[model samples]
Target: MFRTALRTVLAHKARLLMTVLAVMLGVAFVSGTLVFTDTLGNAFNKQSAKSYKDVAVSVTTYYSDDDGADGKKQEPGLSPKVLDEIGAVDGVASVTPRVDGFAGVADPDGKLIGNGWSNTGTNFAPGENGKDPAYDFTEGTGPTEAGQVALDKDTASRGEYKVGGPVRVATNGPVKEYTLSGIFTTEDGAVNAGGSLVLFEPSVAQKLFLKPGYFQMANVTATPGASDTKIRGEIESLVPRDAEVQTGKQLADQQAADIERELSGINQMLLAFAAIALFVGIFLISNTFTMLVAQRTKELALLRAVGASRRQVKRSVMAEALIVGLVASTIGFVLGVGLAVGLRSAMGQFGAKVPAGPLMITPVAVAAAFGVGVVITLIAAWLPARRAAKIPPVAAMSSVHAVATMKSLVLRNSIGAVLTLIGAAGIIAGASMGKDGKFSIGAGAFFSLVGIIVLIPLLSRPIIALVQPLLNRLYGVAGKLAGQNAVRNPRRTGATASALAIGLTLVTGLTTVGVTLGTAIDKATTDNIKADYMITMAGGVGGLDESAVKALEKAPGVSAVSPQRASYLVIDGKDSSASAVTPGDIEQLLTLKTETGSLDSLSGDAIAV
Candidate 1:
C-alpha cells in the first residue's frame, strides 16, 4: 500500500503542488520565528556580558513600588552620599557612578541622530587613568569639564560631529551647547543597542540630565584577588535600606532575561500568524484530498474487486499525505533559516540593536515544524481517506460519478442550522461578559465559520444564480459559461468557494474592526481634547520633568498648561490605578460631566467618589 501510495503521489505532482505549497508556507513561518528568536537572544547575551566585563558589583535602588500608570518604572535616584558609602565598602577597588538619561541630539540638518534605543550620559568618574573600561577613546580624550562632551564613533559619523565641533543637546530642560571634546567607542563599538551614545562631564550631566545630588547607578570593582561574592556582600551591608547590591554576573543575567522577555513577544506574534496560515492550509488540503478521492473512486473500487481490503485502501491515502508532509517540511525548514537572516536585518533597520551572529536552529524547532505539518495533513485527509475505503466492489462496474443523496443533504443542513444557532448564542453571551470573554468568542467564531462552510453546498446555487446575470453582463459569453459551469456541480464548486470565503471573512472582520477603532479615535479627539496642541515625549519611558513643565508654562504664546501624574497602587490586595490633576484648571482644559457634584467643589486631598 505504501509503495502504491508513493507512485500515486509521484504521478499526481502537478495536482498536489498547491497542497505542498500550503504546508511549506506554514512550516516556514514556525521555523523562521524560532530561528530569529534564538539569534537575537544570543546577540543580546553576548553584548550584555561585554557591557559588564569590568564591574565586580553594582549598587542601585530596589523598587518595591509597581510601575506607574504609564507602564514604566520610575528610576530610583541614588544620592551622592550613597555613592560615597558604596565606594568605602570593604574590598571595593574603584567606583564609577553612571549619570544616564535621554538626551535628544540633532545632526547638522536638524534631523534626530538616534535609532530611539540609544543611551546618552556620562561616567561621573572615568577611572584613575582617565579612561572608563566600558568605553575607549577613538579620536580624542574623554570629557573632563562642564562645557565638554564625548560622542560614540557611530553617532559622531552619523551626526557629522568632529573632535572640536560644537553640538546642541536637549534634555527635558532647555537645549544647551557643548563642545564635542572627543569620540569614543564602547567594547562592541555598537553600544546603546545600535542607538546613538553621547557622554558629557559629570557636573554638566548632573545639571542637565538628572536632578542635583542624584545618580542612576554606581558600578564597583573589587580589589585584585578579592572575590566578587565577598565584595557584593560587603557592599550590600553598607548601602542604604532602599538600595541593593548585585554581583556583576547577576546584573548581566538579569539584563539578558529582560531582553529575552521583550523579544519573546515578537516571536509569539509571528507564531500566531503562522498558526493562521496553517489553519487556512487545512481547508486547502481537505478540499484537494476530497477531489482526489472522488476522481480515483473507480480505481479504488477495482482494487477492492481484486481482493484488496478497505483498510489497505485507507492506508494508501494516508501514506500519500505523510510523504507530502515530509518533503514540504524539510524544504520549509531550509527556507525558514534564510527568512530568519532577513528578519534580523529588517529589525536592525527598525532601530533594534541586533548583534551580528550565526543563526541558531534548535532541535525542538525542527521537531515542531515536522510534527505540526504531518499531523495537520493526516487529520485533514482522514475523512476523504475513509470515504475512499467505503467504495463498494460493484462501483467498478459503473462509470458514472456518485451524487449527494436527499438523506445526506437533510442531515447536513440540520447539523449546520443547530451549530449556527449555538455559535450565535455563544458570541452574544461572550460579548456581554467583557474582557474575560476571549475564549468564548474564539470558540464561537470557529464554530460559526465551520457551520457556514457546512451550509455552502445548499447556499452556493442560489447565490451564484443571483450573481450570474451581473457576471454575464460584465464579461459577456465567457462569464455566462463560467457561471453555468460553477453551478453545475454545487458540491465541488461550494467546497472551493468556501475555502476562499473563509479567508475573505477573516480579512473583512479585521478591516471592519480597524475602521471602527479609527472612527472612535477621531470622535474622542474631537469631543474630549480641548487643547490646540499637546506636548508629550516620543518614548513613554520617563515622565516629563516638573522643571520642563514650569519652563513650558512661561513660554511665549502658551496659555494654561496642566500636568497630570499617574501611578499604580495595590488597593485591598488588588492592583488599582490613580491619576492626579490640578483641581482649579481641570474645568477649563477638560469637559467634565458630573451626575451629582460640581467640578468647582473639588479641593486638595478631596475624594471624588
Candidate 2:
C-alpha cells in the first residue's frame, strides 16, 4: 500500500503541486512568527544580562502614579545621603548614582535630532576606574562640568559633533550649548530607536533636571567575594519605604520577565494572523484533494478490483498526503528561519532598535511547525479519501464517468442550505448587539464560511448561468462548451471556486475595516486636538516635571498649557482609569463636550464627566 501510494504521488507531481504549496504556505506563517518572537526574546534577555552582570546588588526607587495622603503627588527620588550610607556598608565596593532626564540634541543645522517626541539624558558617574559601568566611552572621557557633555555614538555622528566640538542641547527649559567631552555606545532601547543621548556631570544633571541634591536612583556593587544577599539586605535598610532593592541576578531575571510580558501581546496577535492563514489554506488543500480523487476514479476502482481492501485504499490516499505534508513542512521551516533574519534586518533599517544577537531556534517551534502542517493536510484529505474508498470495482472496466448521484446532491444541498440559514441568522443577531456580541459574531463568521464552501456546488450554477450569455457573446462555441463542462460537475466547479472565494473575501473585508478605522481616527483627532504642540515622552516612559511645566508655561510665544496624567485604580471594586488635568484650561488645549457634569469648578478632588 505504501509503495503504491508513493508511486501514485510520484506519477502526478504536477497535479499535487497546489496541495503541497497550500500546506507549505500555512506552515510558513506559523514557523516565521515563532522564530522571530524567539529571536526577539533572546536578544532582550542577553542585553539585560550584560547590563547587570558586574553588579552584586542594585537599588531602584519604586515608581508610582498615586498621590499622597495630603492630596499632593509624592515625587520619587533618592537623597545623596542614602547613596553615602550604602557605600559605607561592610560588603559594598561602590555606589553609582543615576539621574535620567530628557534632553533634545539638535543637528548642526539647528534642527531636532529625533522626531520631536523625546530624547534621553543621564548622569555619567564614573567610579575609581574613571569609567561608568553602563557606558563605554570611545573618545575622551565622561562630562566633568556644566560646560561639557558626552554624547552617545549615534547622536554625535548624526549632529556632526566631534569630541571637542560644541553641541546644541535643550531640555523642557531653555536651550543650552556645551562642548562634546566624549562619545559612547549603549544597549538602551530609546537611544537605539534614534533618540539622542546626553551625558552630564552628576551635579550638572541634577541642576538641569531640577532635582537638587538627589539622584533618580542608585546602584550598589558588592566587593569581590561578598555575598549578594547580604549586601542587598544591608542596602535595603538605607533606602525609602517605596524603594526596591534587588540582587544582580534578581534584577536580570526581573528585566527579562518584564520584556517577555510586554512581548506576549504582540506574539498573540501574530499567532492569530498565522491561524487565519492556516484556516484559509484548509479550503485550498481540501479542494485540491477532492479534484485529484475525481481524476483518479478509474485507478482507485482498478485497485479495488485487484483485491485491495477499502481501508487499504483509504490509508494509501492518506499516505500520499502524509509524504507531501512532511516535504512541504521541512521546506517551510527553513524559509521561516530566513524570514526571521529578514524581519530583524528590516526593523533595524526602519529605526526600531533591538539588540544585535544570534538567531534562536527553539525545539517547540520545530515541533509546532511540523505538527500543524501534517495535521492540517491530513484533515483536508480525509473526505476525499473516503469518497475514493467508495468507488465501485465494476467501474474499472466501464467507460462511463463516475459522478455524484441525484440523491447525494440533494442531501448535500439540504445540509448546506440549513447551515447557511443558521449562519445568516447568527450574523444578524450578532451585528445587532454591537461590542457585547463578539463571540457570536466570530462563531457566525465561521459557520457562514463553512456553509458557503459546502453550498458552492449549488451556488455556482446560478452565477455561471448569469454570465453564460456574456460568455457566448464574447467567445461563442468555446465559451458555451466550457460552461457545459462546468455545469455537468457541480462538485468540481464548487471545489475549484471555493479557495478563490475565501481568499478574496478575507482581503476585501480587511481592506474595508482598515479604511473605516483610519477615517474614524482622523475625524476624532481633528475634532479633539486643538493644541499647537503636544509634548509627550516616547512610549509614555515619563511625565512632565513641575519645573518643566512652569518653563513651558513661561516660554515665549506659548499661550496656554495643560498637562494630563493617567492613572489606573480599583474604583468601587472594579478596575477603572482616570485622567488628571488642569482646571478649565484643558478646554484651551482640547475640545471638550460634557455629557452630564460641568468643569468650571473642577479642583483637586473634583470629577468631570
Candidate 3:
C-alpha cells in the first residue's frame, strides 16, 4: 500500500506540488520563529555570564525600579563601613565597592552612543594588585586620579578618543573633560551594550554618581577552596540593612531570566503569525486532497474490486501525505535556519543587535517542526482518505461517487453556527470582565476564526450567485462559466478563497482596532497632560534630578516645567505608588478630574512636593 502511494505521488508530481508548498511554508515559519528566539536567548545567556566574570559574589542594594529615583535624590548605598565588615569575613579575599550610573557621550554626529540608554559611568576601584578584574586594560593602566577616565575599547575606537586624549564625560550634572588615562575592553553588560563607557577614579565616581564614601554595590572575591554559598552566608550578616547578598551563579541566572523576559513578547508575536499561517494552510491542504481523491475515484474503486481492503486504500492515501510532510519538513528546517541567521544579521545592520553567539537549534525545536508538519498534513488528508476508502466498486465503474450529502451540509453548517454564536457571546462577556478576561478573549477569537472558516463553504453558493450577474455583464460567457464552476463546488471555492478572506479580515480588524485605540489613548493623554511637552528619564531608571529639571526650565522660551517624582510607600499600611508633584504642577501641568484639597495647604511627602 505504501509502495502504491509512493508510486501514485511520483506519477502526478504537479498535482501534489501545491500541497508540498503549503506544508513547507507553514513548517518553515514555525521553525524560523523557534530558531530566532532560541538564538536570542542563547546570545543573552552568554552576555549575562560574561558580565559576572571572575566575581564570586555580588552584594547589591535591594531596590525596585522606583527605588532608583530615591537613589538619585539621596542614594541608599551600601556604606564603606559595611564594605569593611564584609571584607573581614572568614572566606572573603577582597571586596571592590563600585558605583554605577548613566553617563551619556555623543559621537561627532551628536547622538548618544552605547545601547543609547546603557552608556555607563562606573568607578574604577582596583584591588591591591592594581587591577580591576572586570576590566582588561589594552592601552593603559587604570585611571588613578580625579582628572583621569578610562573608556571601553569599542567606544574609544568609535569616538576616536585614545589614551592621553581629552575624553569628555557626563553624568546627570555636567560634561567634564578628563585626560583619557586608559582604554580597556570588558564583558560587562553595563559597558559593552553597544554604548560608550567612562571609568573614573573611585573618589570622582562616588562624588559624581552618589554621595561621597558610599558605594552602589560591592563585588566580593572569595579565597581559594572557599564555597561561594558559605561566603555569601557569612557576608549576609555583615552587609548593611538595605543590602542583598547573592552568589555569582544566582546573579547570572537572574540576569538571564530578565533578558529572556524582554525577548518573550517578540518571540510570542512571531510564533502567533506562524500558527496563523499553518492553520490557514489546513483548508488549502484539505481542498487539494479532496480534488485528488475525486480525480482518482475510479482507481480507488478498481483496487477495491481487486480484493484490496478498505483499510489498505485509506493507508495508501495517508502514506502519500506522510511522504510529502517528511520531504517538506526537511526542506523547511534548513530554510528556517537560514532565515534565522538572515534575521540576526538584518537586525544588527539596523542597530538592534544582540551579543554575538552561535545559532541555537534545540531538540525541542527540531521535534516540534517535524511533529507539527506531519500531523497537520495527516489531519488535512484524513477526510479524503476516508472517502476514498468507502468508494464503491460498482458506483465508480458507472462514474458516480458520494463525497457529501444535504444531511452532512446541514450538520456542518449547524456546528459552525453554534461555535460562531458562542464565540460572539464570549467576546462580549470577556470585555466586560476587565483584566481577568484574557483567556476568554483569546479563546473567543480562536473559536470565532475557526467557526467562520468552517462556515465559508455554506456561504460560498449565495456569495457566488450574487457575483454571477456582475461577472456575466463584465466578461460574458467566460466569467459566467467561471462563476458557475465556483458555485458548483462550494467546498473547493471556499477553501481557495479562505486564505485571502482570512488575511483581509484579520488585517482590517487589527488596523481598525489599533487606530481606534491609538486615538483614544492620544485623546486621554492630551486631556490629562495640560503641558505642551513632558520630560522623562531616558530609560526610566531614575527620576529627573534637580540639575535636569533646572536645565529644562532654563531652556529658551520654556513656560512652566514640573518634575514628577515617583515614590513607593505604605499609605495606611497598604503599599502604594505615589507621584510627588507640587501644587504648581497640579495647577499648570496636569488636568485632574477632581481636586479635593485646597491648593494653598495641600502637601505631599518627600522630595519637596
Error of 2 at 231 (Å): 1.6
User: In the order shown, what is each candidate's alpha-carbon RMSD?
Assistant: 4.7, 3.8, 4.0
Pairs that collide, model 3: 114-194, 114-195, 115-194
Q: What are the per-residue Cα lDDT tens digits for candidate 2 across 1-609? A: 999999988998998888878878778878888999899999989988988888888777754567867787755678877778888999888888888777888777877776544488889888888898889889999998879999989888878889998877776556678988999988766686668789998888988764678787777777778999998887878887678888889989998998899888877887787787777777777877887787787888888888999899899999998998998899888888888788888887766677888888899999999999999989989988888887778864583435678999899988888888888888888889999877778788878878888899999899999999999999999999989899988887887788788778889999999999999998998899988888765345456557777888899998888888897678789988888888867988899887777888798777775
Q: What is the lDDT of residue 406 in candidate 3?
A: 86
Error at 455, model 1, angstroms: 2.1
| Count: clashes, candidate 3 | 3
**lDDT head-to-head 1 vs 2, winner:** 2
Candidate 3 ranges with C-alpha deviation above 4 Å: 50-53, 63-76, 114-117, 260-263, 424-448, 568-572, 593-609
Tell me which of candidates 2 and 3 scores higher on lDDT.
Answer: 2
Task: Count clashing pairs, candidate 2.
Answer: 0
The digit string of per-residue lDDT tens for model 1 on 493-564 reads 777887688789989989999999999999999788776777664454356778788887899987777888
What is the RMSD of candidate 3?
A: 4.0
lDDT winner between 1 and 3, please give it.
3
**Residue 496 miss distance in model 3 (angstroms):** 2.3
- Rank list by lDDT: 2, 3, 1
Task: TM-score each candidate.
Answer: 0.86, 0.87, 0.89
- For model 2, what is the alpha-carbon lDDT of residue 78? 80
lDDT against the true structure, each candidate: 0.79, 0.83, 0.82
